[model samples]
Target: MKFDKPAGSNPIDRMRIVGQPRDRVDGPLKTTGQATYAYEHTEIANPAYGAVVGAAIAKGRIRAMDGAAAKAAPGVLAVVTALDVGALEKGDYNTAKLFGGDRVDHYHQAIAVVVAETFEQAQAAAALVKVDYAPEEGRFDLAKALETAKPAKDPNAAPADEVNGVGDFDRAFAAAPVTLDAQYTTPDQSHAMMEPFASIAAWEGDQLTLWTSTQMVDWWRSDLAKTLGVDKDKVRVISPYIGGGFGGKLFLRVDAVLAALAAKAAGRPVKVTLPRPLIANNTTHRPATRQRIRIGCERDGTITAIAHESGSGDQKDGGPEAAVSQTRLLYAGANRLTALRLAVLDLPEGNSMRAPGEAPGMMALEIAMDEMAEKLGMDPIAFRVKNDTQVDPEKPERRFSQRQLVRCLTEGAERFGWSQRNAMPGQVRDGRWLVGMGVAAAFRNHISLKSGARVILGRDGQVTVETDMTDIGTGSYTIIAQTAAEMMGVDLDAVTVRLGDSRFPVSAGSGGQFGAANSTSGVYAACVKLREAVAQRLGFNSAEAAFEGGQVSAGNRTVSLTKAAAAGELVGEDGIEYGDLDETYQLSTFGAHFVEVGVDRYTGVTRVRRMLAMCAAGRILNPKSARSQVIGAMTMGVGGALMEELAVDTRYGFFVNHDLAGYEVPVHADIPHQEVVFLDEADDKSNPMKAKGVGELGLCGVGAAVANAIYNATGVRVRDYPITLEKHLEQLPAVA
Candidate 1:
């Protein structure tokens, strides 16, 4: 089914099951520990354990790696090295090669794997593998490498166009009455997700089956087939449950590939769970960014020219952080330009984290917005509201599908008690702590991908929905069931959702905040088809048929839906294909974040007193799950603002803080209070679901709000990220 036009008077508009604060359908299973994860699958039949051996040097050529001792060790089933893989093809999503090469790309790159009957034996035997490497000098510093950096024609999966602008920014900036130019830096960040990369692989004859924890099932299935030189149909991938991804599990990782190879060699299923330390360096991390933002505005706080330039380093062919993305559309400006430059470095692969581009982008851009507001002696919320654009600032003809940025700002300010905030820095005091409030606008683009689903209506009136969509701890199952129930006019308990299986119809997969909207839309399409089939079977007009009370009615004629399918199960398969609607309208999600913080006058320690986020996504499927996503993102924002740096070791070109102990994340004590509000809205241009993305928008610009609050409280402005007290301690004003 093509979603070429607005969804007009659809069954979903009834809102019988959707748009409710429903509990997660899989919640009980998760709580009871019955939900099986990748490494915990015991049905694979006598599984062996595989332990990875990572490269010791960051950039080097392996001289020799002796795995004979490991293979001959106790309980050892098999041992495989790069030599065993032998000239493998690289997956499209991969930047650095996964295995099968003598050259080491980065520190902790897997060099070999040891498989044994027990995990303990595999771990012990892995240590016996000895390796010699000839190290080479590698570039690890982003700041030092900026001089040689050139504009990237194509940065990873992003567009090749590096610079975009409408009017001349230089002339406007030179003639502006008020101008502010500042630079901000954000360090590399780790995902720090709960579950490490894990997979269990087994082979039967020429076919292979893998149970793995990943975000995109089809991508990994296709990539694994390509990497192993096998037919795509011969490989099956299943990821029914995932602990957490945060964009870390969006692609194929070492665990799945190595497990498959080891299982093939050991003649049994093999499970591989990457160590916490290995996950930090062996996989991907969010790249560090240095952003320069210049805003030219009138004394009345009207922005005229806005220019943003961001520089970041990654491995060759890796993408930049794209920290300039939100600046292009977030505000109203005539002369505007945004550019992203990527430099080649020897760091581990740089890719998506939570919010990716906008997360770090807003960290700098929103702070600049706050500083500009201070210069004009205006309230930050008012300043943002005054510059809100209903249409694209670059292309005035294209209007936003649904934008409530001003509403988000005004409503958030009112709820957060903006009137109580003192504009003067270091004036409001509580005992030995100085308190202040700050605000920042949030923006993330909405996208719709091709998603497919299959619905089966059993004779007993039980509806089964099958799709490859993954939950990733995002409440996909509940929302999907709600969609099916609303469309079929059945109770929520009558719907069964089967997800994360390769055999299921292809879905959008769970990444880029597109899963909920697109996947549910796919289910809506399939259910639409099923409704038509049932109406046809009952001798009723499909268009005029009303599905209610478990019956299909047209005028005076009514028939029980179960009676239509009493002979056998009826199957319906369809997908939502988008047309030119996205091109005609600028679709995006908007939000505003407010934060109040208290800073110790002497120690300069900052603690968040309260935080609130007002979001305007379209037609929230489940209010409970959406709120959970926003609050979780808000907590992650606190971590980005006050902590959560990868702590790079420049000399060794690797992340120094590789484990949770060395890396500091926020605890309950750090976040005193958090609140979230969702503005009621719907965008017909988005899809049949009328929904946009809210998960990433909650995190965007939140870090800058915290930073602004710290500045308002202490009179010390820190442009660097993870605003540790060490950065501003010397500059802090002494309390009276």
Candidate 2:
């Protein structure tokens, strides 16, 4: 089914199941610890354990490796090094090599894996394998590398110049009555997901089956085949359950590679789980970014010109952070410019995490917006409303399919009690605490991808849907069951969803916030085919047939849906493809974040008092799950604003806070009461589901809102992220 045009009145419009707030169907299993993760799978017989030996040097060549001690270690089966595998091809999705050969690209790059009878034995044996390295100086600092940064193209954009622009930005900015220019920096961040990278691999006569923790099963399967130099069909990847991803498990990591190699060497199944410290420096992270934003506006607060320039570092073939993407579309401006510069750095590979570009981009841009609002002596929400655009600012002919940013801000302001916030910073006080409220606009582009699913109608009246989509703790299982139940005219309990198996049809696979909408649409397409099949078997016109209450009705004739498949089980397989609708319509999700903070007058410490997010993503599938996703993102936003940082060790070219003990995230006590409100909306141009993603939208602009709130409370503007109290403590006003 090609979703080339706007969706009409479809079966999903019946609000019986799709829109209802439903509990996760997989919740019982997860809560009971019955659902098995990658390393916990017990189906394989007598599985060996593999422990990886990471390289100590960030950049250099391994002079020599001594595996004799490890080979002689008790319970040690085999010690496989990169040299044993010889020169191997890199995966298409991998920016840095998963396993280092003679050359080490980054710190903690896996150099060898020790297989043994038990995990402890493998770990102990891995430590016995000693290696000598010839270290070389590598680019470790983003600020120092920025001097040599070169203009890079946005991977998501069309083929064009390195810098994208419209009209004369310099001239307009110079002529504007009010202008603000500032630089902001966001430090490197870890996904810090609960589930570590883990995998269990088994081989039989050259065929390999891997039970792994990953977000994109098909992508990993294809990439693993390429990386292992094997036939794609011979490899199978399964991950039915995942603890958490946050974009960390979206690609093939070292765990899967090492597990496969160790299983081959040991002549048995092998399970590999990466150590906690290695997760930080061995895998992907959100790269640090230095962004300079210039906004030119009139006294009335109409944005006349805007330019956003961002610089970030990555591996040699890696792309920039794309921090300027949201700026090009957020507001209405005649003269605009957005540029991204990439610098080569020998840090862990930088890639997507949560909201990625917009999360960090808004951390800087929205704060700039607040600053500009102050310059105009206007309320920040009012200033944003004044500059709202119905059409794309860069491409005037393209109009937003559904834009409710103004509504989100207006409604969120009223709900959050914006009128009570004092315009003058440091004026309002609640005992020993200074109080302030801040708001920031949230924006994330809607993306649709080709997704397929297989639906089976059993004689027992149960509908089963199979797809390679992953849950990743985002309620994929429940939402998919809801879609299938709504489509098949059956109760939610009667539908079963099997996901994250390579044998199933390929789906969107949970990334870039596109999983929920696109994957469900695939299920809808398969159900449509099933409906047609049922109509044909019952001798009714498919177009006029209605499926309801487990019965197919046409005019005065009706028949039980079970009768259509009484002879045998009915099967349907289809996928949702797209045409130029996305190009013609600027599909995006909008939201507004309101945060109230109390700053310690004496200590300059910040505490969030309350938080609320008003989101306008099209047709939320399940309010319960959607709210969970939004609140989770809001919590991450708090972390980004006040706590999270990777603490780069520039001298050594590695992350210093490699473990959770040194790295800090928000605790339950640190978070305040959070409320999420979804504006009722459905984008016909998006897809058959008419739903857009809310997970990333909930995070976009949240960090900026928190930063703005801190500034409003203390009368101090700090452009750096993780706004530590020390950064503004000395500048705080003296205690009264």
* C-alpha lDDT of all candidate models, in order: 0.91, 0.93
Predicted candidate 2 versus true structure: per-residue lDDT over 603-700, tens digit per residue: 98899999999999999999999999999999999999999999888888999999888889899999999999999998999999999999999999
Ten-residue region with minimum lDDT total, candidate 2: 153-162
Enumerate residue pairs that collide in model 1: none
The true-versus-predicted C-alpha distance at residue 370 of model 2, in Å, is: 0.4
Q: For model 1, how many clashes?
A: 0
Error of 1 at 623 (Å): 0.4
Backbone clash pairs for candidate 2 read none
lDDT of 1 by residue, 576-599 (tens): 999989878988999999999999
Best by lDDT: 2
- Which regions of candidate 2 are displaced past 4 Å? none
> Which regions of candidate 1 are displaced past 4 Å?
153-159, 733-736
- Residue 505 miss distance in model 2 (angstroms): 0.4
